[model samples]
Target: MSTEQVEVLVVGAGQAGVAMSEHLGTAGVPHLVLERDRIAERWRTGRWDSLVANGPAWHDRFPNMEFGEVDPDGFAAKDQVADYFADYAQKISAPIRCGVAVTSVRRNSGRPGFTIETSEGTVEARFVVAATGPFQIPVIPPIVPDSAGLTQIHSSSYRNSAQLPEGGVLVVGAGSSGVQIADELRASGRDVYLSVGPHDRPPRSYRGRDFCWWLGVLGLWDLETPPAGAEHVTIAVSGAHGGRTVDFRELAAAGITLVGRTAGHRDGVLTFETDLAANIAAGDASYLALLREADEYVDRNGLDLPAEPEAHLLGPDPACVTDPLVELDLAAAGVTSIVWATGFTTDYGWLQVDAFDEHGRPAHRRGVSTEPGVYFVGLPWLSRRGSSFIWGVWHDAKHIADHIVTQRGYLAYRAPRPPQ
Candidate 1:
């Protein structure tokens, strides 16, 4: 295989990878982006057809390119998001080598660069940006029994409820992914079972104001500087989808059964905690109280506000009248489909770098990793609460790019090769 050298090499060309590449280009850095498949393949292939962004279109864009005239509160379809990313790569003229699968990334011993081994070839770079996101890895809980004989699939593999086995569908995990999947499955005429878990609660709207509008007033999006020792706050808040906080009362009213975490599934018998209903109720209350506090803070601060319409906030009153944790034998109920919207994990086995923490995330300070010249962007939270969001990534990308330029002396160092 032929070897080529560049100043920087970016792995994975998703939203994060493309954003990092754009920033690097703005800084006049000589870099190349390696993607195992075409850019945004995850979005193109992993998401469901009815899957719309829980957040509005405004939050789904990348650096400098606004998702113009799109629906404000309307969710952008997965295809639209993929198309937007493709257009973004084109507009930025990102130096991307598509179909180049980075098999491993190791710190070049005794050298000031990193070695990126790919199926295409190997290349060395003084700087590496691991924009491969956390969602690449799917977490399949070990507790799910193999003999259950139900068609089980993770959120990444689930494309639609049509693929579900003919029967009631159980969606485990009440996070954004799980809730949305459950809602979609229910709408598709399936008896949907939702398993609730500990989740952050926010009103669809507070005081007739959209939650995002309040987030903006509270500096949620503009928080570029993270609080001391509060790095996880960024990731938690950005990945959070307040709209996924469905009205349990509404769900119950609609005849959907809520359940506790799946303790274990075996021999087609699904067991749920009896306290599942109480747990969901308490969790929803806690979330609502937190949102109220956030609203109060915004009012007290007297921040400038926009004229956007408010979202409808559902009260804690139970929407569903049925027992929360009613377990049904899947074999008896004829529930053949199980959608595991449990959540995602970060898989960095292919990345041979040393910057990852025990959780397999790059140990970084504001996008700058411990390994010199290595950086990351579009993490759940890179800087503040919104850093992982599309709009948030722009601010972060600019900052990381600026940091890279300042440290690498891009203004002084001439590229060994001309621009491609």
Candidate 2:
């Protein structure tokens, strides 16, 4: 019923949205940011208590503000990161209206703008930035069948190991989240089984230096000018799992049993591949080789490093063997929980725009959508390796903000608002 007008409307006030808002403010762009809940609620409520940033603190900051100079190697605790975002919002005085959930975002047919229908009211804007991150939706494998007896929870719902039922707990998905949760559960005295998948694995540190330092020195994180003929190449970096390469060898040393990808779960029986260990080991070696190549390139470039990258001697590698299919009797193992560390999914059902591809991702070229005046930010691989990382969003945000300013005069054509 109530209507407001603005030059720009930014949806979601998390890292991406906030970054965009900061850039717009710096450029004196008039914009309104709408957040469904308080900023950084995902980090405050969705993450576990013991979770620390997987990357160094330097990589965890937003645009101009850094997370501080201390604890560069150690990852920031979740609360610390959340507080940083809160402080950032206050520092910039971002024009954010919290507690307003956007129900729909449709192009105003006659106004050349978008009408964002929210729980509180409706707002119209000439340009819309879908900064709503990709993690809002969780992807639970359909292969996981429903069983009245076994309890299953996604990584988003999991807070700690205490929530699991008493028995051998099976954690599905061996990504960073899955691996970390499995490690915690096993350490908590629960017999844990981990389902491995196709994931990037790296050591938290190689030798004694943090892995990120090498990444930065090697220009792995500095792909602002991508090489010729490699425009579509996406450099892999760590994300929510912590930017640090996960050390699979460390996981094995910790006595965690690795299993194959989860096939299905029925009647309290979970089926997985028997060659999981071999697959995981092979995957680990491949990732290590990539890092080695990166290190070599850095050295060849004669880049002076503050610290020497350590060569990780993983030791005489164990003979690869097929993962034995082993089912843990929950009752016997006292494992009462199942945490699906499987990654996230993207859902844009509320967006009434034809800018997305078949996979539901916004069709964009470096943040500019096919639909004029529509833009996207905070997506994985939006531009380069660090695009979606906490510190990486700023680069894409600045570019998008610049584009919006340069093209502002051309967006005068207005579309008609749909009949209310």
Off by more than 4 A, model 2: 68-70, 222-245, 298-312, 315-323, 326-335, 411-420
lDDT of 1: 0.72
Please provide, for model 1 over 50-142, each residue's C-alpha lDDT reduced to its tens digit, 9 standing for 90 to 100.
Answer: 666656665557646776546666567777787888889999999988998888888877867788888988898887787787687787787
**lDDT computed for candidate 2:** 0.74
Q: What's model 2's lDDT at 27?
A: 94
Error of 2 at 113 (Å): 0.9
Give lDDT tens digits, candidate 2, residues 94-125.
Answer: 99889999899899886578888989888898
TM-score of 1: 0.85
What is the TM-score of each predicted model, taking all chains together?
0.85, 0.86
Model 1, residue 327: what's the lDDT? Answer: 57
